[model samples]
Target: MRTVTRARLLIVCLLSLRYGGHDEPAAQSHGLFCASADAHPTPFILRFRKTDRAVILPAYLDHIFDAAAAIERKNARRYLYTNNNDSWEETPFNHPSTFDTLALDPGMGERIKADLDAFSKGESFYHRNGRAWKRGYLLYGPPGTGKSSLIAAIANYMQFDIYDLELTKVSNNADLKSLLMQTTRKSVIVIEDIDCSVKLSNRDGADEASEKATDSNTSCKLTLSGLLNFTDGLWSCCGEERIFIFTTNFKERIDLALLRPGRMDMHILLSYCTFHAFKKLARNYLGIQEHPMYLELDEAMRKTSIQLTPAAIAEILISNQDSPDVAIREVLAAFPKDMPNERAGNVDGGKCQLSHNESKQQTFRQTMFVFFQKTKHLR
Candidate 1:
């Protein structure tokens, strides 16, 4: 009986081994269920019931990680990224401007806000429509017209990062592309005074310059075509939810390519301060929407041919903050007598259109001019 039992056990073992060779091992069927590090260094579990299941696991994990990252970015505080050595670096983004504080035309502000809201919520819509999830804005105005301030206000309103792209620092088209790729989604890529930064000329002029430079062994050349490609090329669609803002005092100097319909989605002309804008400034600075002197100030602004920038008006109001009446009177008195129809000529076309530092000097000149005129009249 013992010999028979041994023979049966041997036969069963052989049968089991033969079947196992044809079928998968139990371990193979169960798969290696364990935690593994993802590309982002986040640990996640890997479980599989079949050999073919692992094929889809990486893609599944990637989707989950992407979703998580998108949520994190949406909630995270905004950053001000600057380019350094062809890479991006983050810095604390502390911009104090908001939509409420910004002195813009009521209708214009509302339109911009509406557009921003649509863009933020229309991810699926953009995909369905086969349109790039991006928007471009061209802000053209004189110095102190609040172009930079408007940018800050938009950034604050959208809770988006600001990538102040300094074209002069960039080496070439390749460097520009690299810098743009490094930028994350939901950020503003600003090229302030684009015309001044590079020689934004017609296609013929750019080609001629490129040809000359190719012959001469010069350093990196930034051509108009390269810039347009950077803004609206196929690579520009690599990232999503981005805003391209270009500011220039001389809109006429900007290349026609940039002004084309689809290139700059919106052409915003931030002209001189209107009475409506002044009312906003008054409410912001003096905390009074309707003061006794508002009518007089409105009349004064209407009668004056000079177009005062929001910055110039803001300085006058803040200077005499202690007394609302004094501030209003001072602002009214400061209106330039020579309301030249062409103040654009005063701006240095070769330099930055309207820098913050230059705004102060311009405001000082405006104030001093008004002060001198007033003093002379008193005498």
Candidate 2:
């Protein structure tokens, strides 16, 4: 005979047991068995005490949730903080930038990679020192010097998602903290153009401060104190294994309080392009291991130090890549034609090798033109 039952009765009994009621079991006591389509075993949850919670809740979560699955496969995601219904919106991040591909000095790039590796593996060290498991990086460089690309490379190398926090978009300190709270572990919190993001109270401009000054509820002023708290305060301990990145074009504009070693940590300067960086670009663009023009390029760069940016130089290489010889000459031309290095460029004791290079350049241009004409006719 099937006996009728009610959910209220089950809840009443469970509540009675949970609240220390010594009610005797009903004669027709029944047990609830919950199951799912998932194959993993689900532990039966009966009590409401924290002891049971400590033992069983996390085990249940571990069975169902896999936070590190994507990270293990080197496929992390990117998240942007938003002021809409949700705090952050997520998307798959698959940036191809790596240490090898960056147009940065090889030595500097390697050191940065090593630093990232050490931080990722420094869980024990952080815990031992009684510090939160977070690292801060300050990338300061002029525009087009690959600050954004470096961030992408860091994310790819570390296998961590990027959480790009826009301070200007945030209404106030409380909002900022809330946004940080929603961010998951093993993620990068990047604030690009920090100097341009917000004109905080401690910095310049009384007019800007007056504009930001408003009721805390409707429009709260985001202050330097709040930003510092977001970086290193108790509220910042919401998650573990986070990375904070602040990038700026003008480091001088930023307040000193934010640039301290513990707060900003490593301050990396992505300065103007070096000849070593040009070689990396050549390898990537022209597929060349060695070239005579390499010496000329180096000599030209060394003469009073050409301040061409990596992006600007890379553009020349990328555009003229079809003709490698022409590309090399163009890059050399980009630098000042100061006296040629005797050993590197010229054979006749430090005289300019313009005639020789011009002759080669003319021949290559003719060859490309002839080849293109023939191909055009054939087509």
Candidate 3:
């Protein structure tokens, strides 16, 4: 009996070894799996392959791998991004057909046209070493001289986004750099009324001393060197394909450091409208090719001290767009009856004078400003 029991126990041990040996090789050591509650008693089990530690909780590892894979898939093609604090609002900018179609001074118009053409062809006059693609325009003159209008015309012509930098909103050079970086390519960066934005440093010391004497509590965050470095320094090279436009009511007020050669690629003197400019405005606003008053208006423009700005002409034309005759009549009505011989000889008057044009330009500038402000507000 004892011999029979020993033989039975040996048979049982042999069967256990055979089953365990076959099971070890069938379990997989390394393979991923997602857990499903439907699977069985254990939340996860080893995928069948020959290894230990193959089983893992799908919640612990599967979700992490899935998230990583998702991120890689989403960011596969994006390369550029721009961010700014200013609200992204669309402002209507329609290029005035009259301004483009009319012939002003052939010489000035041709030069401006050539420059704009070059810009359209992707050629920058200042950049030499394949770095820092920027163009600067210094538009300086008295108020009511079509400075802002020129900006609008340029923007409309180029179809470029305008990044109107409010210097007061910028804290310092770093802030300025960040703002510049946020501007996309094929855009214009404008700093209008720059003279008032910051207290500029002066090399002559006279201007600096004068400013110091006048205001003691003044604190200037932007210095001349700071501005120069921002525009021309190596840092400016970070951006490509952009235009920098600076407009000031008084160029003389700006330090020479700001206006040195290469700093301002172009200095557009938006003076009062000449006889040529007036005729062009007429052709544009009023479609009268050959009016009876054409020669008289021309002679009047040449001889009369009355000087109308393009802005004033635009307002008169806009108000009477329905009737070219009314626009022409209004323009002539605004002119003085007696043309000043000396003033007429000078295309642009030196200072404020009692001329028909002077009064018209003043009124035009104010009215346009209000118009633009309202338009901007609406937007």
Q: Number of the top candidate by TM-score?
A: 1
Candidate with more favorable, higher lDDT: 1 or 2 = 1
**How do these models rank on TM-score, best leading?**
1, 2, 3
Ordered by lDDT, highest first, the candidates read: 1, 2, 3
Question: Of 1 and 3, which scores higher on TM-score?
Answer: 1
RMSD of each: 14.4, 14.3, 19.6
Question: Pairs clashing in candidate 2?
Answer: none
Residue pairs in collision within model 1: none
lDDT of each: 0.72, 0.68, 0.58
Q: What is the lDDT of residue 343 in candidate 3?
A: 47
Q: Model 2 off-target regions past 4 Å? A: 1-86, 203-220, 338-379
User: Which has the higher TM-score value, candidate number 1 or candidate number 2?
Assistant: 1
Q: What's the residue-level lDDT of 101 in candidate 3?
A: 56
Task: Pick the lDDT winner.
Answer: 1
Across 142-242, the per-residue lDDT of candidate 2 in tens digits comes to 66679989998888777777888876667777788888888878888899988877666642324455336333432446777878989988977779999
TM-score for each prediction? Answer: 0.69, 0.67, 0.60
lDDT (10s digit) by residue, model 3, range 1-379: 1222221111111111222333443432223222333445334332322232224224424655666655664443322222233223344444453237543454765776577767666655435546466777898765666676666666555556677776555444566666666677767668888877666555333465333311332433444555787677776667766777899876767777777755678987766666677777667767666677767666666665556566666677777778777666666755566757564333334433444455556666556554653365378
Native-referenced Cα lDDT, model 1: 0.72
